[model samples]
Target: MTTFDDREKAFENMFAHDQEMQFRIQARRNRLLGEWAAAKMGLTPEETDAYAKAVVQADFEEAGDEDVIRKLMGDMTQAGIDIDEAGVRAALDEQQVIARRMFIEAQ
Candidate 1:
């Protein structure tokens, strides 16, 4: 391959790797946020695990974090936890940091 082809392939590989890392980070953050909310809502250990998985799946509903936020807000409200979207957003922000740390440690 030409030098240009090699450069292009390298860039593509890097982009793919970055995309995967971002996905992992987001998924980790979602799980962490779910666990936090579950505790707040008094979910049992078994329920917490299922709720965390559901939160991760909720990310697939949209392009950004809106889907996950919406799900959390809805679930919290249904449980009579009296939480707002902004509160959930804050939890998401905190979880993002935890997720990054966990990912780096794993690496």
Candidate 2:
């Protein structure tokens, strides 16, 4: 391949890698967020694990974090926990940071 073609391929590969990493980071964040919400709801250890998985699955329902947030909020409400969107958003941001840090450390 010509140098230009080689460079283009490298950039495409880099973009793909970045997208995969972002997906992983978001998934980790979702799991962490699920764990946090589970604790707030006083879920049992076994239930917590399942709930965390459910939260991660919720993300597949839509394109962005809203689906996961909605699931958490609805579940929390049913559990008689008082929390708002802002609280959930804050937790999401916090967990994302933790997720990114964990990924970096792993590398």
Candidate 3:
């Protein structure tokens, strides 16, 4: 292939890799947040794993963080956890940072 074609392929591969990494990071972050909330709510190990998986899936419901936040807030309130929206958001942000670090370090 020509140099231009090789460069185009390289760019496409980079874009695809970046997109996959973002998805992995977001899912990991969501699972981390879910585990934190689960521990706060006193769930057992099995329950926590299930809840964490649910949280990861919850992220796919929409384009942004709102879906995860809404699910977490509702679940926490129902379980009598004394967490607010701000707290959930803060945890989400923190998990995102941790996730990014974890992903980068793994690379």
Per-candidate RMSD, Å: 0.9, 0.8, 1.2
Per-model CA lDDT versus the true structure? 0.96, 0.96, 0.97
Candidate 1 wrongly placed segments (more than 4 Å):
none
lDDT by residue for model 2 (1-107), tens = 69999999999999999999999999999999999999999999999999999999999998998999999999999999999999999999999999999999999
Which sequence of candidate numbers ranks them by TM-score, best first? 2, 1, 3
Minimal lDDT window, size 10, model 1: 82-91
Candidate 2 wrongly placed segments (more than 4 Å): none
- Measured by TM-score, how close is model 2 to the native structure? 0.97
Please give, for residues 1-107, the per-residue lDDT of candidate 1 as tens digits: 69999999999999999999999999999999999999999999999999999999999998999999999999999999998888999999999999999999999
For model 3, the run of ten residues with the poorest summed lDDT: 1-10
Residue 5 in candidate 1 has what lDDT? 100
Residue pairs with clashing backbones, model 1: none
Clash totals, every prediction: 0, 0, 0
TM-score winner, 1 or 3:
1
Relative to the unseen true structure, what is the C-alpha lDDT of residue 88 in candidate 3, on a scale of 0 to 100? 98
